[model samples]
Target: MSNFVEFTFRGQPGYSEPTAREVITSSIPVRTIAIYCFDPRAADAAQAVADYFGDEVYPGDLVLDEADRKIGSTATVFPLIVGGGRAADALRSITVSQHLFGIERVVVVHHSFCGATSFTAEGISAAWKHEHHTDISSLYDWDGISIADFEKSLNYDVSLIRNSPGTPKHIEIYGLFYDIGSGELTEVVRDVPAKVA
Candidate 1:
């Protein structure tokens, strides 16, 4: 755990006589819900997002495929350590977070040139079968990972949370496409449901 270093002034309001105290360390501020993002390079991107958004970033992984390493942070709208095309698996976390913190907003951040979209269903099946000596083709759903699939997959993930009976209906969902080369976050807007009269 890291301490927060801050500055303070010891003086009356609008008084010329002002005293400055040395930098003091304090506990980091508690934050609300964060954006759910996925990418192999999500950790680095999450740190950059935290720095850009002026927030402290901590580490947490949505999946435990690796050695308990820091995968992502919940400080700001940034990516979490997640497997490619596996954003739907995070619906439970989203629901739990909202239930606990009363979060009404969630941002799904997917990136361009993702490794998730790099394989076809056949290729993925073959690779998985060879690696694990098991046939997973019949059960696995992600068939093709491509640029076209990015927004579609993101929308599918949003729908999973938004349509879930366990999740509140009023929760607002937003999608962002992060460009890996340019470090830009672009909004992906589909048709928004019309407000009831």
Candidate 2:
């Protein structure tokens, strides 16, 4: 297989390239699918896990445990797709990946004080009207796009994935609330285990 995987960042107005490819390394294992927001404030959970657990399990450049033996077969990460769920296109891409990959589990992480919450319905509609010069007011709702409350939004998105036909019934989905102030990850949905072993 090619070393690089194709990716399309949808609904990002400022993103220069419409699509890009990310190179995959032989290390990180693909046991779980972690869905984190594109916010830079949140820590990289995959990297943290790899760092704390030692490279024998999730090998990294700094991990030195049995480095020689773990060289080519060392632990690494699987394909991770990060984007804002507020956009319709992003949600579609996420669902499509779930359908095709059939990943065992998914962890949806929502952080406090997100940028998506800043966008209002009036602003979005005005932007659309300005760009397309047409009245699409009835097509989209601002309330749906905004993320005023992280916990509520997290639950809604979790439910959305659970109910989505694209995601398999066997796939376990989870919701996480990240407090940016204190740097903590709290599980919003307790019915299923969200932590990665």
Candidate 3:
């Protein structure tokens, strides 16, 4: 009944969820998901990951249909920008991306001098309570609210993604620390599922 329904795959006649998913999977060449901070200074994080992999394509050209309608892309890396590049906020996206694009790798990049390092979980909670008169200390995991150490944060995030049920067991997960000033990435943690015998 809604006008937007016509824009959705389910709204089309002869629409099948499985068929639509297959089409989407074949259309995009996405093999990696890059999760990084929303900071403007760290915008090149995705490209850096692609370069690190040496086989990925970032910002690849778009493919168009006969009618010039944009349909697909040659990009292999999809960037999922978020605050602090926390895995807590990227779990759902990882799930959906795996469902549709069948990603082979998920990279989490935490940048140097990020705003997330500026405040503690308790500090944010207390500030929210004083300013908005709302208690949110228990609403989120305290450890994920801010970054204390890059190695610890990266390791925690990589473990979180690996342990998530929605994340495919076969996929590789990596945690990297990006230096904003130097434009360099340092691998802090890498979680690759052991190959089955």
Task: Go through the candidates in order and give each one's C-alpha lDDT.
Answer: 0.52, 0.54, 0.95
Off by over 4 Å in 2: 1-29, 43-102, 131-144, 190-197
- Between prediction 1 and prediction 3, which has the larger TM-score? 3
- The window of 10 residues in a row where model 3 has the poorest summed lDDT is 137-146
Once fitted onto the true fold, the runs of candidate 3 whose alpha carbons sit more than 4 angstroms away are none
Give TM-scores for every candidate, taking all chains together and pairing residue i with residue i: 0.58, 0.58, 0.98
Please, what are the lDDT tens digits per residue for candidate 3 over residues 1-197? 88799888899999999999998999898999999999999999999999999999999999999999888999999999999999999999999999999999999999999999999998999999999999998999888769999999999999999999999999999999999999999999999989999
User: For model 3, what is the C-alpha lDDT against the true structure?
Assistant: 0.95
> Judged by TM-score, which candidate is best?
3
Leading candidate by lDDT: 3
RMSD of each: 13.2, 9.9, 0.8
Q: Pairing residues by index, what is the TM-score of model 3?
A: 0.98
At residue 183, candidate 2 shows an lDDT of 64
